[model samples]
Target: MKVILVNPPIYDFSAYDVWIKPLGLLYLSNILKTHNIEVVFLDCLDRSYFETLVVKPDGTGKLPSTIVDKPNILKDIPLKYKRYGINKEIIKNFFLENNDADYLIISCSMTYWYLGIREILDIAKETLKQTKILLGGIYPTLVPKHAYLTFTNKVDYIFVSSNFSELFAYIGLDAKNLNFTNFPAPDYSHYKNLYYIVTRFSYGCHYNCSYCACRKIFPKYTAKTVEQFVNEVYTLYNQTKCKNFVFYDDELLNFTTTKQLFYEFLKLNLPIKFFTPNGLNPRFINKEIAKLMYELNFTDPRLSLEFTSDFTHDITDKKITFKEFEIAVENLINAGYKPHQISVYLLAGLPYETLNDVFHSLELLSKYYVRIRLCELSPVPKTQLYYQLGLDDTVDPLLHNNSIFIFNGVPGKVKPWCSYEELQLLKKFVKDYNESLKQKTIHSYAHY
Candidate 1:
């Protein structure tokens, strides 16, 4: 059997390549190869697809994009809608060339980016008329009914289950026979030029925050042994000689195994840098762990501090407290990390949250030396906040987009918490506050 796995382009107001790779699709590729099924992978968002783009030293860069017309739903938004990836003609030509595949599988990430999947489905249906096409990933998994209705005739099937048992059954295979204990690392060999690799030490989160979808996607928390995690990292590093590694774990420091993993990493003594794009739980960071992370060359560490107000504790499940956050910052700074090098993520535009609440959080964060990242909330389907707002499955997924959600909340369902102007002012406040700290650091250095 032959299968073509595709990572579709993202259609959004803005997009960047921050060590983003199709890790799930690559893992599926390895599984297919184990069954002797031939796999052909195409990543539309691959940086190597466009040779003219520049990449930074840490493997983070911009993607090649072309401005496209916005959908009628988003027409009022001032930002230019863009298709960030290889051109449509390139995708069409590739499908035409490889039309003989028996099955075509496409992966989707953000629910708001389904337009890219629709485009890929249209092209696939036109070129590979005889092949069966399947769509699966975060989008479809979260809103299966909407996905099925949206692409009713375009896709042959939609895989909603995380275990891939339904997919195996449809393809005439028994998933129960496969052993997951020896699951292979994602097949990064498909990429022409690899820069950084993304891996996870754990599978899911133990806490179920109302705004998060991690619990919905991964119902149970599971982790790989420290030995297994370290061995996989060593193997990938030896193979690609890639020095940058990013952890996609929702809770990188929540478990005891994480400490062992860090010690193992330190023992390697390899000149590699680590990053955590997903913010870490501040409650887990201690003096010892902070020291270990600093020794291991972890860069740009970000802590998850969703809110400062006590009333917001119910929504965040009280995962972190102000005292814990302060202690974590002090530990990191004492471990030799400058305050400006640390970052704290503060969420904005949440339902029932006033602009004063956000501003208060920002003002509190300004007291610290760390930088602040104000994240606008995107109402994900099936999350507790989504249901609390009375948003049903019938609502268009486009309404969940963070870019326009702040300015224009669901027309009749929810009112805008803050206007675009207010959001801009809040951003400026953070920028100026961070800049003040930077100048202070410079002056202190000169004085010393």
Candidate 2:
């Protein structure tokens, strides 16, 4: 049987390539290939079209996008809405060329970017009437009822289960016969050019942060053995010659095998630059791990210090204390990393969090020489914060966009915690504070 896998375009106010890939879909493709099923992969957000767009050495870059009309719910927002990816004409031409596939599976990422799925569905229905279309991924899995109701007639089926049982059954394969543990690495051969590889050592997070959906999406914490992970990375690096490798694990350092995994990576002695885009837990970063990460060339390591105040403890589950953060910073700096090269992610615009809370966190962070990466909270469905606020599934997912949610809030559901101007001021404060740090040449040991 022939199957087509598609990674839909993103419809958002702003979008950038931070070593993003359809990892789950690529794994599914590998499974299908193992079962001797023919697969055709199409990534709508492929960055190859924009030849002039400058991509960094680490493979992060901007996507080629075009302005589009905002939805009625977002019309009042001042930002321009964009369809960030290849043009629809390319999708149409692709379907016209290969219309004989028995099944077409479309994967989604953010819930707020569901419009991209709708766009792809329209094109698929018009071009391939015989193909059975299926929608899956974060959008449908998080809010299955809404996804089913929205695309009731458009899609033939919606795969919402966490495992591939339902999908295997639909495709006439038994789940018990497939080897879930030994699946091959994600298939990146479909793309003409490879930039970076995004992989995961673990599946889920042990900590249930109120604002995070990691536990909700992946209820159990599971990890690959050190050998399994190291071998995969080594093989992929040799195969693609891609120097940049990113870890998408929700909890990279918290895993039991993490330290050994890093030791194994260090032994490879390759010139690969590693990254942890999903910020690491500072509490787990001891001196040994910090030194290992430095020797392994971990670029701009970001620590998760969502808030510094005690009031936000319940929201963050008291993940890391300020003392722990200070130690992590000191450890990295002592291990040959400059304080300015380290970054901390401070979450802003949380429920019940005031501007003063954010300002205080920034004030405390200013004492350190690290860079600040401010993150705006986007309430995800079924997360602790979502249910705590008494939000139902009826709320439009588009309102969950962090860009406007921090400023406009949810219409008639929730009021804005901070106005647009206040958010801008906070951003400027962070910028100025980070700039001030860059000018200072204080010794790391002296500061401690």
Best by lDDT: 2
lDDT of each: 0.85, 0.86
Per-residue lDDT of model 2, residues 1-448, tens digit only: 9899999999999999988899988889988998899999899888876678888998999999899999999999988999999988999999887799999999898889899999999999899989999888888888888898899899999998555778888878868854435667888878877888888887888898888888877778877788988999999899899999999988999755898899899889988999998999999999999999999999989999888866676545768888888999999999999888999999888876788878877777877778989998898998878887677799989998988888888888888888888888888887777777767733222122
lDDT of 1 by residue, 1-448 (tens): 9999999999998899988887778888988998999998889998887777888988999999899998998888778999999888889998898898999999898888899899899889789978899888889989999998998778889998665677888898768854334567878888888878988777689888888899888787777788887899999899999899999888899878899999999998888999998899889899999999899999989899888765686556679888898999999999999988998998898875788778777777776878888788999988898888788898788888988788888888878778888887777777777787867631221111
Where does the lowest 10-residue lDDT sum fall in candidate 1?
439-448
Return the clash pairs for model 1, or none: none
lDDT of 1: 0.85
